[model samples]
Target: AELEIERWKNENAPPNLPELKEHLQTKKTAFVLQEKRLKRLRLLIDSNKFAEARSEISQWKKTGEDLSGLSEMILNLEHIEKSDDIVLDLKRGLAWQKYPDSYIQNLKMAVDRCKSIQSIPRKSFNWRIPSKDELLLFFTSNIESKVQYNSGSYWSSTTDKVWSDYNWIVESKSSSLVRTLKDDYKFVICVTDASSEMIYHYLDTLKF
Candidate 1:
């Protein structure tokens, strides 16, 4: 639950990666399903059917569904992307994630959520907070038009050399990168390997 805001000097430190592909597969599948369920609940709330909405959620509780992410998802409904697609940018060799434990978090938490999705099979790719340059690739006019990406200021793993506590973030609105405190709350988009083999591996493992 604790997202670590990395010190500037430790920007290149290795991430905590999930070794079991099966675990990653199971977790990703459940998360995608839960997101679908929440979207339906979101529609109910939008329609102002408060009682009906609460009743639907009661069923989830009875079925032992994990509602730990419920509060954050429901409260931040507007900012969260509706698409559950795991996008692959072949040119960059990166596969992007649409969901996070919370859409908005401090730099540390955002990176932690990304690291949770990393899988190390025979051919490995680690997920972590993208660097400023990596994130810039997403903010481009051409890429923006093609990808179903989340729109907002996003924290980057790249940090300042001198400032030590400052980090870079991309503001989607202005399409610019700026320095800010590591503790600042911002959105996240996690990326991992999108190699040819990894692509097939992801679809087969996660059942895309």
Candidate 2:
């Protein structure tokens, strides 16, 4: 009777084993399909086909499919695309090179204020403006130097060295206002940090 009982148990276990193996196989297949879909979506995004990629994602969602890593991938791709688009727009606009007319006028006012001050000496000067390339070199070099010195937050804490080299002789001083001599120039060439509000002024002072 014990032998008969053992035989019955063996028969049931073997029959159930195939079903368990099949279930695991189905799960593996589903995972692979999801992975393939995710990879394709990524490729589309990289190719700059965001609309289609989004549409495909919507379709997947409608089908109640959960992509294992799709959400993170989509977010990353969107971020990259937005960053690239912004750079492209900035390059096209050349917004950094020329100050707006109002800003230029304000700078002129500052210069004029300096001229009105009696204590400042006005010297006739013909100074070379630094080029964009030169400014970039100076800005990068300064940041690098700060890093070398082991300064904390090289971008924020370091004084903008761009304008520091010039003889910032108070060109003029009114009752309470003073202006630097170089303020007359519409756009003084300097590497400006948009985030740090720091500029390396008078980069032209460098021998190079």
Candidate 3:
């Protein structure tokens, strides 16, 4: 009699478990569809399809769809493009033909200022001044020459040819020679103000 009562109860119970399972499956499908849509939007933006990407965003907005991911993607793409544009502009400006005459002159003036700040010391008695050949060789090899003698003072010549005329005279001594060179000669036909240290550093940085 107890077994029969148990069986009857089981038969009469409502079948709600299948309904709950179906609802959960439907939610999973919707989540997957949203993820795919977001991925496509990102791809479009990355490929520079801004118009189509923007249109998709508009549709999402009208449908009251969540688009936090898509909006962030678009913002990131725009930022990357802006940064690239600035870098391209600087590169183009550095090219001899691309820069305006006034800009080049300004750059030269800045270099001159850096040179004025450099230190120059008289040659010591023991160490000899480099000869013209030696100077040329040093310049070609891209090496700065420093002469230290028994006296407490030492003299240094930048290997750059810009100061070759003033080469005999001691000029600026700051280690940041490249910045000086760039600032002084960016616009000049002859980069006479460039320092050996600057040229060496520039070449070394290039691994050339």
Candidate 4:
């Protein structure tokens, strides 16, 4: 709309048609307002605020303004929560399980438990118990990812250097890591590395 108004202004004289000039100016103003709203929508998406982004799109639609490709983008946002319930972090080369396993047990068994899920999500992520550093990534990424786990005190592959039987575990509720004995019960979340080709396809789907 803004470009159209600019073209009209360039091709026509301003004083000859006052009504047309007013219409063009009005269109330019509306486009600017929409551009601002679109910026906000992008910010929301970048922050992993899909629910709010959906609301924004709905409200915009109610106003009767076309969002062009953005509307289709929102419509297909379900691609993130595909059949496997995996969320991809292409930048980190990781695929995170959207939910944790229900059987919260001793840390000693966490690794083996996670191994069972390796075949899930097409085994593309090679899912298994994450390392301490890898698990730490979850804490920092929590806000930026749509994945959420109900269980807390997740086990990590990294064991305590000082204690042979202790491993570091992350608490979902507190977002903190604490060293715990192998016998301590905790939840499990599997993670795997993402491939470059997978990233390419994901980006292609989003048309970004």
Number of the top lDDT candidate? 4
Per-residue CA lDDT of model 3 for 86-108, tens digit only, reads 11112111101111123333333
Estimate, for each residue in 1-208, the C-alpha lDDT of model 2 and write its tens digit: 3354456565755566556666767777776876776667656755767667767766663344343234333433343345422111122211121221123322335334334432211121111222334333333432323211211111111122466522221111111112233323332321212210010122112121
Candidate topping TM-score:
4
Better of 1 and 3 by lDDT: 1
lDDT of 4 by residue, 1-208 (tens): 4565467676864564568767878777876876777678667766656567767867763444344444444433433434457777767767777766777888657777666773443323455788987777777775225776765678888889999899888887666889999998888888766534443343344411
lDDT of 1 by residue, 88-177 (tens): 565775656644334589988887787776332212456778889988987773545655556788888999988989999999878798
Using all chains and alpha carbons, the TM-scores for the candidates as numbered come to 0.49, 0.32, 0.30, 0.50
RMSD of candidate 2 to the true fold? 19.4
In order, the Cα lDDT scores of the candidates are 0.61, 0.34, 0.35, 0.66
Q: So what's the TM-score on candidate 2?
A: 0.32
> After best superposition, candidate 3 residue 70: deviation in angstroms?
4.4
Candidate 2, residue 78: how far the Cα is off, in Å:
5.0
